[model samples]
Target: MNLRLYSYWRSSSAWRVRIALGLKELEYRYAAVNLLEGEQWSEAQRARNPTHQVPVLEVERAGQPPLRLVQSMAIIEWLDEVHPSPPLLPATADGRARVRALAEHVNSGIQPLQNAIVLKRLREKVPGWDRAWAQQAIAEGLGALERAVADGGAGRFCHGDSPGLADCYLVPQLYNARRFGLETSGFPTLLRIEAACAALTAFQAAHPDRQPDAPSSDPATSPATSPAAAPAAAGRSP
Candidate 1:
């Protein structure tokens, strides 16, 4: 199978897919999509995903038409189904539901509120609302996640000792929380899980700083770098 991922370096959703692909030990061509410069609105990108989002996956198999998949959660689930050696979800039905619930706590409840497009719209209508809104959303969502993990029989990772779907959703959201300047010391459980994930090469390779389109310098200080202009060698492997 030939796989290609359309991703933005700092996008939490794309980061989730990156982590999933890495954990599955799959190699794919990295096609960088720069969200900072409105590249996601381009004709080509829109054609790939009408919603105009990053983390679109293109899959090619023998004697079949190529498949274009969108939405990070859907793509990751499909990948997990196709490649089950290192399962992303638990084996038991109840366990899968628990993990999916944890994953949705981040994917549905939190991410949309702080999404770039959502922030941009808020900024246009209500001046100076983006940062505080994103911070609150992340903080509240993470607070709930912390309590859920604390009560949900969490072990080394979110579900059990294994790093599964919930962990894949989590680490990136924590990154976003930090980027938005939220103090995360309150969520010790989530932080502990994040520490465990940090030790894994899969999570390390999926980090925003390690992406091909990431700026050479600090993204906060450096001017926006176009993915089209950058070389695609950085994310060639896990």
Candidate 2:
């Protein structure tokens, strides 16, 4: 199979897919989508994803039309099933459900509210929109995540000793939370799992600052300036 990933350098959703690809050891061409500059809304990109979001995975096989996948979670799950070694989901049904639930706590609950477009909208529509609103949303979601991990679902990495789906979701959200200045001092188990995941080369390589599209000098200093500067935010998946 041939694979190509359309991603933004700093997008957490795209970062999640990148981590999954790294863990699965899948090689793919990187197509940088500059979200901050509104490149995602371009006609060509819109053709790839109607929702105009980053992290579209184009899959090609020997005798089939190119499969265009939109959501980050769906793309990662497909990769886990097709690749199979070092499985991302657990073996048992209960285990898979738990992992999926943990992942969704971030994917569905936290990520949607913290997306760039949503925040942008809130800023324009709401009265005196502040970064505090985003921070509060992040804090609430992360609090739940902390409890989930502390309650029973965490090990060295969110499920068991090895990093899996939940770790994929956890690491990126933590990255974004830090970007938003959400204090994470309360979530020790989440922090511990994040630290464990960070030790892995896959997670390190998939980091927002490590992407080719990110500015070589400083990723945070520049944004909404160039494609290189376009990465410093969270994303929505079409």
Q: C-alpha displacement of 7 in model 2, angstroms?
A: 0.3
Per-model tally of clashing residue pairs: 0, 0
Off by over 4 Å in 2: 217-238
Residues 1-238, model 1: lDDT tens digits: 8778888889999999989988887877677788888889999998999998988998889999989999888999999999996999999999998899999999999999999999999999999989999999999999999999888579999999999999999999999999899999999999999999999988888888877678654544222334433222233232
For model 1, what is the error of residue 170's alpha carbon versus the real structure, in angstroms, after optimal superposition?
A: 0.4
Candidate 2 lDDT over 173-216, as tens digits, reads: 99889899888989999999988988887887787776667868
* TM-scores, each model vs. reference: 0.92, 0.89
Q: What lDDT does the true structure give each of the candidates?
A: 0.86, 0.82
